[model samples]
Target: MFGWVSGFFTYETTKSVVVKSWSVGIINRVAQLLIIIYFVGWVFIHEKAYQVRDTGIESAVMTKVKGFGFLNDNLMDVADYVMPTQGASVFCIITAMVITANQTQSKCHEMDQKFKCKNDSDCESLTFSNLASGKITGKCIAEAQRCEILGWCPAENDIPIEHSMTEVEGFTIFIKNSIRFPLFNVTRGNIGENLKTLSCTYDPVNNPDCPIFRVSDILMYAGEDFSNISKKGGEIGINIAWVCNLDEHVDNCKPTYKFTRMDSAFKNSVVTKGYNFRFAKYFKSEDGNDYRTLHKAYAIRFDILVSGNAGKFHLIPTVINVVAACTSVGLATVLCDIILLNFLKGAKQYKAKKFEEVSDSVSRSQSLDLHECSQKTIKREEKSSDDSGAYSIGHQV
Candidate 1:
């Protein structure tokens, strides 16, 4: 029990071994220097370990388009071509339209050629045929070989007229975007602060602060042909990036612009070709009946996307990273110990010096034997002195 208690209370400490060779010293110092450089140059300065970052950005965007074009013998303005003319961020510029005029509520034949059949029984093979002008009447009229429908007389032709609003290439777009970082309480906009954005067109090298962009230039930046996209209508993206280092001047945190073709993958799709939607304009006839003109508009859509990260100096991050850097420097000792113990020429000597052991059992046994030997030697000396004094007295008598 005593031995167990003594063993349990034993103290252990680290052994320091100073190696005084050129190779080992050089290796140790070089390892420490490299560790210091890595933390200072990469972890602290380049990565900005001393700052706190916010990526949750709140943003608002508004856009406007301005241009005029002559299409199908009609003068078209922004009010005519721009869908949802309220200047929203995501808007479409119509390039082509299939107009079906004077559609009244009556029975009509489907315009789709796939619905054409010889008899009513032939159209019966298509059970769920809703692609007609309206609800199917379940009869194939002999006059028209297509299936009969019960609404909108004189069915709309699915064929679009070959009218491309090529003049849209010259149109200009103005974008106003505002972004905020809630953590830092900073708000910024893409347009110039002096309000000169209205008169200037955007050029990467000349007028980067302007929010205006030309249609052709946007397509050029996205590597798309304006004429091809205007014919069938496709989606384009306008990306605004606001990467800010809040430690610097606020003026230096202006937004950067990028263009992308969003619908490039489905450009050649046969089933879902391009971007189009249908809407109708109603009119009241003199006979008190309602009639309408349906328009299927093919348009180029633009989506404005905003993204950003803002970083600023903070005391918590600075202190935490500084402590981490200091703690990380101690790794050099481990690296040097590994090289010295396993790979160096005098590895045995270094390994021996770096480790030491003290056993209590061996020390206790040696001390007990030494104490017993001194006691016996003292007894023998006293006995010899007594004998010598007795023999001298007898000889003198």
Candidate 2:
């Protein structure tokens, strides 16, 4: 009875030890998972976003920390391992929902068009003749379909922005030619990545008297991957500047121009590429000093660049070899096909000639036999008639 009691106690002790070990193992796993989740969500995703923002256009970036989606595929390693618990899954879902809602609001605001220009003639309203002195004030009565005022510039007649008009003529021509080009069909949401045209107005904020020139149909490509871009992709910067040339236009003054870059700064506005320099104020061209015109107009362009090192060596070498080999094979095939076609045509002509010769020989033989038979019939008829006439005379005697 004592032995039995001891055995019962030992079994209970073993069971408790087993339960404690299992509980410890589970806790360790959960802690490890949580740590991994926090690290990846806080570090890698934010780092990538910051890098994207350093570039000069507005950008909406969405990174998934939860279930599988486009960008979440990249995060699957950590997310799947950590999200097994009900609490973790719920947390990730909440985070994704908040991000998505913010994206919708941002997108809705961006899609709201804010600028209007009735027609191309409205572009002429951007002349310096319409600017107000001291307090910049001007207006062009030109009508436009729609226009959004992004920013304005102010310039002093005495202190002109430097080098703003150096490439005025060329820049003007580019603007005119750009009109001939088609408007960029920017996608409205996260479905596709593209740059949308934003209206830029250059009127002095302090003084409302300035001629506002409108840049229409500016071309810009987004620098974000499709999965990373938000439904409301982001805003494009419309940089503008008011630059005056003091030297060439002013009597007895050294040639110089005052220039300033202007644009609206918004959240998610920075992308991987630098901001557009179209509206940037800089001295351009040292020669040919007509600095007073202030006829320069500018636009922005955005380009996205993607860099990765996976399969670098194998991919490049394989592609190079494939292209070289394909070109060679294609050229050889084309040449061989041409040669074969020509040979086949020659052979057919040779066969046709042989057939024509045989036909000609048979026709000639048939014609010769027909002529000989006709001649023999004619001679036989003549001889029979003569013999009959001679027999009749002998009978009469």
Candidate 3:
């Protein structure tokens, strides 16, 4: 009698909250099971039972269900009769379950980190891209370069010692790249819960953008060649290429370039920790590879920076599929329940045995009446011959 289910079937907001917190792995299964169960219970035990009954002739529209094989028979065999009446109910419940389950599991979270070079030379410029629509888009905004004097040089005829005329230096190029983030367990307590942006700056030597143009922009001509014998930092090398605008059919322009590389000098170049750079390179290749490839191949190293809490749970598509399956099962269960109730009703068949007995008696009485009529005809014929007194005597008697 703990049947508080009548109007007591409350929506569990708490359940929804729990579901949201639940990882993508189990959410679908939970939702699916709930849907299946709810429908099966409702259709067979609750809704189906309430639907079948006989009140009065005028109010007996509900009696249409009675034609479904006496309601006393097994529902499985007699389900055909009731299916027509209950079909819509079954469909509605199924639909409702699927919709609710999907709605409950649709939230997801993502973290996107981005970096940009300080200037064009430091970045890859003039990228020609063919989009999905077959249209070409030009990238790497072109900026006008001007010669600025760093200081009035005592010696004449020397190129102006401007602050690296192409201020394209200080770029942190990462070669033989590798990126490592604490994979939850790996970081253990070292990792923080929040998200933050970290920035680090490095000045590449003889710096590529110096007053004098360098032939190998791809090569790092810095005074401090930082190469380790162990190569612990992964396969390391510097590459330089000029930006080509494929769509414009231009191979190279007035070559003013910048230089940057990722080494120990920066405050926070450990990329995995959070700080990184998105840079541009000159000269894409026949291999159809670009700076993006480098990013994927190797991530810039930088310090780890955590600013805020990244909630732990992520909802996956599989979870939704599970919930849908569960809902479908639940609907099926409800249909089964409805069929069961119909079966029970069919089992208790309407006993019209009295009508059979009365028909039999009437048939017997009809036969006897026919025999008596034949005998009366015979007597009438026999008395006809001596009709005079006989007929009168018979009448008087």
Candidate 4:
């Protein structure tokens, strides 16, 4: 109980220092140097360890495409080829189209290759599947041996049409982008000047600042051909990246753009062939009858994707990184101590000098008391022996 009470209040501490060796010193110095390099080179210079980061970005984009071509021997303008006419941030221009003109609400004609039947039971009063163009009426056109669907009178032609817009090679798209870092209170725009962007084109080596890009150039950058992709539509992606260091001047912050083709090339397979969609334009005849023209438009889709991150100096991160670097330095001392006490020559001697057993005041007092008790017991035994011998001699006399 006494020993436990003393131990509860007392603690052991070592006070010896080992004579340092060249090998140990070298190892420690190397460890310290590595820590210093990591803190200064990587954390401070490269990663900006003193700064906090904010990636929240606010962005807006405006895009416009310009081109001209000949469609079916008719001169076409940008207004004729571009969808929605007014243009949007994301838009497409038709490179190929299948036009079905002058149609009214009537029975849809069936293709000879798709629908085949022998009698009315095979073609009449049949519910069409979801993939069917329209609902079938209870009438079979025996000549075609197919069901009639109550839809646009004349069915759209499925004949293959190969139209190419090679003239669109020189077509250019103007992209205007503005980005803001709310945390750092910094904002940047791709266009430095209105006239500069209007006249220049995006060229990595020569005119990188220009926001105007040629469609053909973009296709080429993505390892695609304009002539080949024009026949069958595809998707193109435009990526704008902004990495800003708030410590520098705001003007230095600029965006870099990348182009990639999102869709695979044509593989001559019907399932994964190309991208196309159908739209209709309705017109009223002089007799007040409704007529429409259906157009299957195939065009390259452009998707503009924006992303960014911004960073600025802060005291909290700096302090945290500094503390981590200092802690790593202490690890070097611990490692060297392990090597000296366990691996080096004369390690046992060094261990004995380095570590010493310690005792509390209570333990010392208890040890002294035990020694005194043992000495008193030995003296009592010797005196009893002498008394026994004297008593025996007296009795004999």
Candidate 5:
């Protein structure tokens, strides 16, 4: 217990010496240089280890599409082509649609030729699910030789429809984007001056500051043709990237836009080829009966995706990286020490000089006690001898 108590306050000391060896010296210096380059050049200069990072972003987007088209021998304006007649971050303009007008709730005519049967026994009663348009009525239509279902009358036609609105190639889309870096307290937008934004279109070389984009140009950039995709419809992605270096001027923090085709082209395959959805317009007649016009809308969907990160100088990371570099440098010293004490010709001598055994406090105290006891015993014997001689002389007298 006493030894442990004393050891708690005691510190082990080491002696420092300089050893000159070409092989060890060269290896050590080379390791140090590599570490220095990695830390100073790569980490500090290239990666900017001194800076902290912020990935949080706040963004808003508004888009407007303008174009003209003709359908069913009638001219359509921008409002007719654009859905909902309002601007949004994500919007679609109708390139093609299959209309099923005057649809009412009644027995529907089954169009599948395979579903044709001689009688009710061949038509199995089935429930209506999302995949199927209606439930089976277990009846066969004599004229059509197809099974009759109790649902919307005159079921939608399965024939493919192709309507090309190639005029949409001239459509112009104005995208307004505002992004903020909360941590850095910086805000940026794609728009420059109001006049420039209104007049100029986005051109990588000439007018990069403009936010207005042409639909044809975007399709071209994504390796697609507007006329080819206008009939079947497809999806296009708009990516806005904001890479900010807070150390530079804030004007350099503007967003860059990129285009990509998200949906597969029609030439690839017949299955899952294009983008389309069903929508209905309902109205009440004079007799107070409800009726709806079901329309299968095919259009190009533009999805706007935004991403970015901001970085600024900070002290905590800088210190941490510096300390890590220094710690790595110590590994070089360790390598040299291993070679000097275990591999070289004079390794045995070096090892002997480097390491020494130490005695514990208990063992040292016991050794001192034994030496004192031996000395005491020798003195007592000498005193006893002197007394015996004096007594013998007295007896002789």
Candidate 6:
């Protein structure tokens, strides 16, 4: 019972062992230096583990386009080429158009001049988008093999007329972007008040900070041919990334622009190759018959995409990473201990000193205690027999 109680109350403490050898000391110090270098150079400095990062950013963008071009011996300006005319982030610049003027609501032949059919059964109702120029009556006109459709009369001949707005290549696009990091409560913009926005145009080396961008340069950056894309419309993506390190001056945190062809995958497609849309201008005749001019415009679409993150030094991250770096250094001891116990010349002696445990000494002490008890019992019985004439049952006769 006493032994069990003593064992229950036992407290085991770590024994510190220090080797005074130069070789083992150098190995231990080198391992610790390597660990310190890894933590300080890679984790703390390069990885910026001491900073708290905020990826949740809010953005607003506005864009404007300006250019002039001559088409069919007629001069046109921004109003004539740009669609929506709102100067929005996503806008279109018209390159070529198919115009069908003076269209009145009446039954007319189907659009495809190559479509020849003698009967209504050969035609189907094309009320779907891109297919539905007009409502098909399912009756083939006897004069031509075209199906009769009731909607816009004198249905638009969607034949491409080679009208090149090549001057659009020299057009200038102005972008204004503002972004805010809600966590850090910091806001930044792409434009600078001191720069000359009027004459400046974007170039990677010579004029990077300019808010104005040329159309051809943007296409060049995207690795697309200006002449080829101008013939047929295409979609382009403009990416503006803002990466900030709050430890530095806010002026150093600027946006980097990237351009990519959004429809590069379908650029080589045979059918759905480019971007186009349709709209109409309505008018009323003297006889009150509603008439309109339909236009199918092929245009290049510019979609501005913004993304970014900001990071700042925080006390919590700094303290936590610092403690982790310190704790990681202790792992060097384990490596050095392994090398000393198993790989060194005096490994046996080092092991003896490192693990100074004595199970045999504990067993010897227990045996000594048992022996003393036996001696006491024997002495007590001897004394009792002398006094009261007692004898033990196991005594030999």
Best by lDDT: 1
What overall lDDT goes with each candidate model?
Answer: 0.85, 0.26, 0.26, 0.78, 0.78, 0.82
Best by TM-score: 1
Q: Indicate the worst ten consecutive residues by lDDT in candidate 1.
A: 388-397
The C-alpha stretches of model 4 lying farther than 4 A from their native spots are 1-32, 116-126, 138-140, 193-197, 264-270, 331-397
The parts of candidate 1 lying over 4 Å away from their true place are 1-13, 17-37, 195-197, 331-397
Worst 10 residues of 6 by lDDT: 388-397
Per-residue error (Å), model 1, residue 237? 1.1
Candidate 5: the clashing residue pairs are: none
Across 55-76, the per-residue lDDT of candidate 2 in tens digits comes to 1212222222222222222232
By TM-score, the better pick of 5 and 6 is 5
Predicted structure 2: lDDT = 0.26
User: How do the residues 37-142 of candidate 1 rate in per-residue lDDT, one tens digit apiece?
Assistant: 9889998889888989999999999998999997777889999999988898899999888889999999878889888978999777764766767888778988
**Model 2's TM-score against the true structure:** 0.15
Q: Whole-model lDDT, candidate 1?
A: 0.85
Query: TM-score for all predictions?
Result: 0.79, 0.15, 0.12, 0.76, 0.76, 0.75
Off by over 4 Å in 3: 1-172, 175-324, 328-397
Error of 3 at 189 (Å): 25
Clashes of 2: 35
- Candidate 6 — which pairs collide? none
Which parts of model 2 are misplaced by more than 4 Å?
Answer: 1-25, 33-131, 134-220, 223-397
Give the per-residue lDDT digits (tens) of candidate 6, residues 301-357: 999999999888999999999999899899989988888778877777666655554
lDDT tens readout by residue for model 4, 199-311: 78899888878989998889888777877778878888888999888888777788888888877655366777767888999999999999999888878888888999988
Q: Which residues of candidate 5, in runs, are more than 4 Å off?
A: 1-27, 71-74, 112-118, 125-129, 194-197, 263-271, 334-397
